[model samples]
Target: MTVKDSCIVEAGTLLVGVGPDGAMERRYDVGIRVHEGLIAQVGAIEAVAYGNDHLPRYGSRGMIAMPGLVNGHHHFGLTPLMMGVPFAPLELWLPRFRAMRQIGNRLDTLYSAIEMLESGTTTVHHIQSGLTGTPDNWHAITSDILGAYDEIGMRAGYSFMMRDQNILAYEDDAKVLAALPEKVRDWLAPKLGAAATPTADYMDFFRAIRSGWAETSPDGVRVNLAPANLHWCSDESLQLMSQTAREAGASIHMHLVETERQAEYALKKFGHTAVQHLQKLECLGPEVTLGHGNWMTPEDLDIIAGCGCTMCHNASSGLRLGSGIAPVNEMRARQIPVALGIDQSNLADDRDMTLEMKLVWALHRETGLFNDRPDAAAVLQMATEHGAKSAGFGGLVGRVEPGLKADIVLMDEKAMARPFVSKRTPVEETVLHRGGRHAIDKVFVGGRLVVDGGKVISIDREAVMAEVAARLEAPETAAEAADWEMVNAMMPHLEAFHRDHPLVGERRPYRFNRITP
Candidate 1:
């Protein structure tokens, strides 16, 4: 593709951004013209049209055109191993992850990417600590995740979790403090082994992986160095990652104080809140997006706004994991771009944005003393534009407009657009109440069809399911539930954490699978 190559695509209801003016409710529909991948024309169907011969057409007669929903924070390869496990809050969820990581590299990557697209998402921001092992053992397996994303025809931002402090949660120091007895030492070896990969080595390891992943799909994937996640990430690692990402022209992602425990940890250890600590380290900026800002104080919210950083609200995960509700209303008031995440393969649940969407409304409605709340349209921005912006796509995506990538989703108009005759037509309300599998008619990534006719078109669904059954199933396929590495190491902590603060599973049986490796 030449730099100046242009293609035209015509669709109904082009939902382009109203520019930097922040007028999201307004849209322009002049059949999109794509030149070198960015949109070139957006207006009436007849005016400023694409060159007919060059622009291959897709007819979205009954579909609505909007920016593809971006998943701002996800652990990319969790799908194949999701079902048949327990939803035991974070503390309980950790040990289970070890058991599930035994699924190995190949199956995990493909399953995660495809499942994401099939469910109507087009871009992903993955907070990757990669598969649980030394990166050398896996050899850019997380990068291979983009292979699946490419095959599925979606855009992605890869953020490798960087940590120097713990050597995987301070495991190195914890390992050789031999004053502890031999029985204890013997027991400690496996846990230490799980965290054994040196942090610096992993950093180089992920950078090389990012390089390779980029080569595989080129423009389809963009990987940024991230602090991985909070709680486990050290101050030095966060600084290094921030510098690396800025120099690389990619954004930095991290889980900043996802829970109350993390908040408490930051206060006691760093003398400031989690956001404040990161601010002091100069880790906040437009190039950074912190996932799960559920425990922010009003002051913390100010810090996020002050730094121009973004927040990803993982609605279901926050509610499920018992992390506090993020102040979406407050963040929006500050003009801080808030985005959405499924937080799936969750050791928790499926990648269902509808569940998350509904929860966003529920939490804010219940909490607000007055009617102050995020309306449907505002949440839509969080899910789409704000998400892409947070993950670094910004104006290049997250909306249908001239000079923007034509990443679009055609929602099922039959169900979602009905009861609509101008006066009753509220696109945002339709999306919130009626949108789901039935409404997700097609999903497009950069003018390519990733989903069509309400199904994923890029991969063989049945074959993928077959692989899931054969490779990821039980009885000799994987390690015994007890024998898994991730589960054993973290199960004790999970159970203990739950002991103090038990999760009330309003929705029971959060699905997960055992990881033997």
Candidate 2:
């Protein structure tokens, strides 16, 4: 089948971008014209001229046109909860993920991509790491991931997760290994047989990916660096990643203080907060985005804001894992750009950015009335503009304007605007309060229709799901079964270790309510 350079037009109530005074502007009966995958014109329908008179037109009525959602931080397309990995702190949960069986890479990626697109997510920052394989193995896996996104027609930023030390605990791996029982230790030997690949090798693989797969497109995929987390990566690894990203003109994303335990680890290991350590390494900049800043202090916020770095708030992930609420309001107060992400752990256990946005909107309203909180517009920006910027697509595909990539979502206005009353509710407010996958009428990326009629258009959803289901039903390998047993035995011991070795410094207030005697 030959792909043609086509033109398309979409007309609806257009929620545009920030105005000169920094307020969101909305216009009714506006039309956007897409030519060769880029937005050509945005204005009154009558004023806009299309190069092709027979081009397709969509969302003529009862629809709202807005920028496509961007998932600022995500992992593989699959969710751990679906595979029997329950909610635990991020540190403990990491091991559980290892025990889960691996399905085909392409199928797993498409599974999440379809869900994301149906929920109006056109772009994602996928943090990939810790896969057990040689460079060739990694190449094949990364190729499969990128291929899936290419077929599904979604933009993605692929960041290879980098870590070198402390694979099991905040302290030395020897200590953690010594603490395990003999049976558990033997079972884990095969899984943890090799030391981490040399940092130079990781850099070489990254260069290979950058040259081969990181092609330039208005709404295509790019590769970035991810230093996994503070406790996982050594200082040398972090420095190498920072320098490589800087030299390559790519972005970096890392987890910082996702939980109180991680905060404690930072103080215990580095003599400072995680954010301060990043600052000390000179890693904070416009191109760096710190994921899950739940335990960031006011001083940390100042440093983040001062450095022009961004933060991604994974609201449902925090709640699901019992991580503390991210201080999004405080970050915004400090003029730090805060974006939204699902982090593969939304309340629904699916990739739904609309629901994630609503959760973010509701999660940070702790202050009394009259205190500034995230309104609908603010949350919308986090899901769209700020999110796009966080994924390294700044000013590229997040707004409905000429010269931007035509990555847009058309929502069913009728579904969102149901139960009509005398006073008309604003479209943005209605979307934030009521919108979900059911309300998504269509999604377009780079002027190509990727989803329509509440279904993804480019791939066979049913076939993908069926294949994955069949693969998952097959019996696990002996290694996998052994790892599962090891995880079960390790959980209690790991929990006890954390409980007994609490932070030495003054601890912060409890993130959630504790049962009192």
Candidate 3:
């Protein structure tokens, strides 16, 4: 039966949490009672339905039930690769990305939601990387993005990236513009000016969006703030973002040290590491989430742990972009919460949290027999609990316990069992290794059956995708073609600007492929 006002979800095996000894804490023959979108009881089916015998029951009789996965860091559903933006280092890729033909907000958001939902992800932290519009424009865009989430029965935390400086490169905008040819410069100036909004206007825009969402949006959607990155935002922008997030009761997510050059840039500009500069600005607190902290130092870890901030690990993005491996094991040792994000750059080029977890599980197995490494439970926790916290849904929808929202995933037990195996293996391990969209039997978000039998029941995935394909099949418009031409014209100047910067040849604390001093 479909989920209604009240329902009972019965699972052959229910995964609750990890124990103190790192073993999976699971129960057999468990039933979860969801009422008014919140979990009311979790125990035997008879106990959960003692007085609610009239309630509908979802028969997950032999399936493995766990908390729905969270994607802590993601952008549009239509990935850059899909838009013809080839993978490059973050520094180089940023400019190339400006040339991608834009997709309609609703279509793009829905496409990603479908991929995440069918693969068992219930929530996503959407950090809008490109901000180019007025408040009125923002209202429509926000509505479309959040509207997509509401239509598909998925949860999302939305934030637009704010940047007031260094739009072209790490150097100042004026300097970069001065070095460019006048013809190219004139073409780029208006484009950049159109995206430029006053610092105060950004705060006002966020306030308006947050207020509107509180009144009309579903409980599953939230509004947060993102300052973009250290190089992109001015000091005033960073401080204001922090203040605005606190006032709005929202969280702040920022990209920091995604590449080694970013670290070197911070050192050259501020005479300190990016983490220290953030602390100096009083932005290193629990309400902040640092994305792709692959170049943080040991001292940075100390500050991050002390401030109780969360770090999102984007393993595949690092590998794909040549960014170094994050110090996830080190963060875990310091009692810092580490979350996993697909970063729209999963190794498979899809939004599969299960596969992301597997890559993380195998990537950080330190040297010898005595080294500390992430086990199955830790990785699962990153995907669920830590991810929930990072996405600004802390203590609300991560666990499948009483008082928590009923966002759950049901995996096919037979698929994981294969054509014969051992019963002694932990359920989390099996799911980590074998579970994926193909193995997801059903998915529920806030007592709503969003996906059933490996298909999203809330929306017509095939039809929507076909429409997107058809819409994209048309040839590029003149504006898009000219944008590509401008990108090509500006590449050499952009390259020279980066190559000749004082910190260009410096080495980060981490290793790289080949660095000639």
Best by TM-score: 3
Please list the C-alpha lDDT of all candidates, in the order they appear. 0.65, 0.81, 0.86
All candidates: TM-score:
0.83, 0.94, 0.95
Residue 135 in model 2: lDDT: 85
| Model 2, residue pairs in steric clash | none
- Candidate 1: tens digits of C-alpha lDDT, residues 112-218: 66666766678888666544476555565664565566666678887666544433222334533343445434655566566545556666765786677657656
Full candidate order by TM-score, most accurate first: 3, 2, 1
* Candidate 3 local lDDT, 1-517, one digit each (tens): 1233568899988988666776778888889999978889999877887888888888566888999999999988777888877788788787887788877899989998898999999999998876676677888888889888888888888998888999988888889999898988999889789878987898898888888777775468788998889999989889988888887778888999988788888999999999999999998899888998888888899999999999999999999998878888888989899888999769988998988999999988866898788988899989998889888888888778899889999998988788754888778888888878778988999888899999999988899999889878989999999988988888888888888775657454444222211
The C-alpha local distance difference test score for the whole of candidate 2 amounts to 0.81
| Candidate 3 global lDDT | 0.86
Badly placed stretches (over 4 Å) of model 2 are: 1-5, 49-51, 193-195, 216-218, 421-424, 476-479, 504-508, 511-517
The superposed Cα distance between candidate 1 and the true structure at residue 496, in angstroms, equals 5.3
- For all predictions, the C-alpha RMSD in Å is 6.1, 2.9, 2.6
lDDT of 3 at 427: 83
Q: Which ten residues in a row have the lowest lDDT in candidate 3?
A: 508-517
